[model samples]
Target: MLYNLYNEKKDNRKEKFWFRAIFYLFLLIFIGTVCWIFFFSSLLKINSVEVIFQETQTEYDLFNKDYLISLVKTAFQTESSGFYLDHISRANFFLFNVDHFSQLIEKKSLWISKVEIYKKFPQSIQIIIIPRDGAFILQGEEDFLVDGQGMVFAKKNDFLKESATLPILSFEMKRSVKINDQVLESKSAKFLTIISSIFSEQSGFELKPEFFTPSLISNELEAQVVIDNGWKIFFNTERDPVIQSKLVRKVLDEVIKEKISDLEYIDLRLPGKVIYKLKGQPINADDSDAQESKSESKEKKDDRN
Candidate 1:
């Protein structure tokens, strides 16, 4: 019986030792995997990057591909911590977050309107950028760059060495504006875009866009465009811009054909009607009607005589 008890105790000791050994093996493996992913794995690291602009070759110079890639690499290198075990501490494949990286690019570049980042598995990334159209420049206490979306992106702190050919907007604001503010109203911006498209569509017209002045009429905002040759064209704030542009083009064609001179302003506030005043004549529909009646009366008197 004593020998049997001693054998049973030995078997029990061996079983406990084996269990502990297996448990420690699994623990070691888990730790090693964690370390490899967090510190040494290259699976999620960005090995290659591609930059694509939605513009033509001439526009590519505005955004440099090498500069963008350098910015992205800098972002990846500075990541401190993340949610999953795949934290991108040192370019680990599983640790890189594309969304966060794209945001970093956007925060650095102000003129970019949209950014799309695509990861092509194991090691490559593609970035697509859409930049804002430098439609107009707002000149006030300082000059600001305004796009077609009416967003003022950067100041005239000498970022762009060459001046853009876009019109200068003279905004009448009650308060000062900051960068990224809607300095030029959306309606005005849209009007200018539509007008430009219309002018382009017409074959024989050579319209040169210039400055715009914002005004308030009857509690509604309106804008005026000063074109080449001292012509002032007005726009209604709430009307259809397409129709208004067509009317302006028609009027211009007529004026050119008739060789009209001493023009003052073309007002297009009323629907289906154009009201214009000459340099020294303040004639309107009422005045025209009154003058026609007097002329008719004089003709009748002469016939009676």
Candidate 2:
């Protein structure tokens, strides 16, 4: 009986030994897999990067390969160094957070409007870029490039200097504005920006005003625009610009069709009305002589009668 008990105990020891061995092997594999997934994995490394610009733009050099690679590397390094003790907080093919990368790109540039990152599993990354739409040039103490949102992105460059097609705005400010600052925050500037968008849509009737002037008249805001012709058209700041523009266009078109070149001023301050002035003709001495002759003839006819 004791021999049988010893044999049973030996069998139990063998079973325990095998169980421990298998458990230890699985533990080692788990640790190794975690390490491989977090680091030193060929499937998770960034092998190739592709840049795709959404539209044709020559303004900024944000799509250079070297520049984008460096930007990505910097973003990943920051993610890896964060204090969160968790599983694989990094930027890689499989583990890269697209939203985080987008946010990083946005923070890096003030002119970039949209950024999209696409990952082709285990190797390549595609980045799509969309820049802000440029509206017009604002000429003040210093010239600036303004966007549709009235945001001043950069200083005026010579590339678009021949943009006579775009309207020029002249504003006077007592304070200075920094780069990427929004200087066109006033109501008049906003109205002008909205009008520019409208002009862009209307291809049939192009309203490319040469200049915009905003001022205060009788403690009320007023805006004036010089159209293609030399005439100065006035607008009331309190009125809706859309309605005012429509009225001005209708009156101007009529005047233009009539071939009237004596236009001096156009006032669109009144609701649903347009007030205009024309250059008056001066009377000459010839007109007086003709009138005197006609009067003498009429007097002689009356005496005969």
Candidate 3:
């Protein structure tokens, strides 16, 4: 009876040992397979890159596709911590840093407001480029597209067909302003948008952009809405456009009675009055927005001198 009990115990020990050994071998094989797939195999490495411009149509065909693709390739090879890549030709799909790649590409152009990246799995990467939209077009001899952030990102030729409908901010350019320039500050850009919509709503006609000059006004702090050759309206770009627009409505309804034929210009920058000039008249005075006007006039004079 003792010998039979010993044999039974021995058989159970052998079964447990074999089970553990087989389990370990399978576990090792699984681990090795995973390592090969993730780290060593070309299957998970980046091989193909595709870039899409969010707004650009496929028919347009990218103007600088090769350059853009080069930019993307450079961005992909780059390391997360540094601007340049280490000697690696391609990154593993799981290891590509999307955030870092986006930042690197966005810095390459002011026109690029955002960049989105997606791993198309196994061996491909997809990139989407979102170009900035214009809040207003700064109409110089060369029209420049201005964004809500007051940045000039692209020229008229570079912008799409919708440029015609956008409100204009015509500048009598004494000096050339180029791409990536902050032609208007953030507040002024917001200010222009408000007043442009107001003018469009009130006039019942599409008006040209408010005119600006380096010497006089409309660079940033002030804007002039020109009617004809010498006809215009002056605005304090700093004030609330809603209140100013309402005051303009009041002046038209009560004072001028909407008779603009003889009107030369209306100045809405004054403290208490809406000052205007007619064809043959002297300047309808305020305090003539004295402090504000005089200071701006002085700056213009200073620029002139």
Candidate 4:
């Protein structure tokens, strides 16, 4: 009995030793994990921030390394420490609120492509931006620069002072052409192409429309073109646009040859017939007089009977 009791005590002591060993091992592991999380994990640390821009303009001060560092510090102090790890950060938060950013950029007259954010670690955030490429100016009430896709880009400070001799688009902003949507109608596209070609071909020919009016004949898809010479040219989209353009060129050549400065209107809707209204001709007046005379003769004959 004494021997059995001693063996049982020895086993109990061994078990206790193993339990203590396991407890100490677990404590060490937990401490190591905490240390790694606090010191070694990148989630808790930021090192350096890189700010990149699309065109690297002098206007974007945030693109500067020093400016970006200061911004990151400011954001860290104002925002939560885990802001970088969060779904949205100060750098990319602008993207989610695109309308706000767009408005801000417009208000500041600055163009932007994209704003990107990257976490370097202990306290650094990288902000990258891609700016829009300003293409042409849309001449209207609020004249603004338009990109290739007809998207209105933000204006720069020098944009107002310095005139960029880009091609002008005579497009009436209708409900069909939404603010953020692209107007890709074949007629409009073709007209723009023709205007571009004209500008490319002749340096003297600048695009200046007398008035941009829409017509309901083609579901308001057609726009009347009036040049500086008071020559009204009807532009139809259903017909072959290239052919119509050629006809217009022919008529212009003829007008120059004939020395015809005054023309009422030129109708190019028909294929072969070019109905042109001549200057100094009483249109509809003669017809009205003839109808009146015929009615008077009919009344006299009725009186005689």
* Per-prediction TM-score: 0.62, 0.62, 0.65, 0.39
lDDT of 4 at 264: 64
Better of 1 and 4 by lDDT: 1
Writing each residue's lDDT as its tens digit, candidate 3 over 79-100 gives: 4322124533347778777887
35: Cα error in model 2, Å: 1.8
Model 4 lDDT-worst window of ten: 283-292
Model 4 scores what on Cα lDDT? 0.47
Off by over 4 Å in 2: 1-5, 52-91, 94-100, 114-120, 158-166, 172-175, 194-205, 214-230, 252-259, 269-273, 280-305
Q: Candidate 4 residues 1-305, lDDT tens each?
A: 99999999999999999999999999999999976566445555444445554453333232234443354345434443344445334333222233443344344433455566555544565566555544444555545545555465543332333533444444555433323434344344345434434532432223343224342113122223434665555544434444545555555565434644666666654445455666785321112223333554576689799
Model 3 regions more than 4 Å off: 1-26, 45-91, 118-129, 139-143, 159-164, 176-179, 202-205, 215-231, 285-305
What lDDT tens digits, residue by residue, belong to model 1 across residues 1-305? 99999999999999999999999999999999977764566655567767676642243233344554465555555652343445434444555667776787678767666778787877777778766666666778787877776778877553433533555556465357678887556766666555654644642243455544543112132344333455555666455555556555666566433543555566666544566656677733212223333554576689799
Residue 293 miss distance in model 3 (angstroms): 14
Task: Report RMSD (Å) for each prediction in the order shown.
Answer: 10.8, 14.6, 8.0, 14.1
User: Candidate 2 lDDT (Cα, whole model)?
Assistant: 0.57
lDDT of 3 at 108: 69
Candidate 1 C-alpha error for residue 21, in Å: 9.1
Rank candidates, lDDT, best first.
3, 1, 2, 4
Each model's C-alpha lDDT?
0.59, 0.57, 0.66, 0.47
In the range 1-305, model 2's lDDT, one tens digit per residue, is 99999999999999999999999999999999978775656567766667665643444332343444455556545654533246443545666677877887777765567888888877677878665555667777776666766687756652333433445666433456556776554465556646644533431244444455542112122333334554555555444555555555656575444644666666665544466766684311112223333554576689799
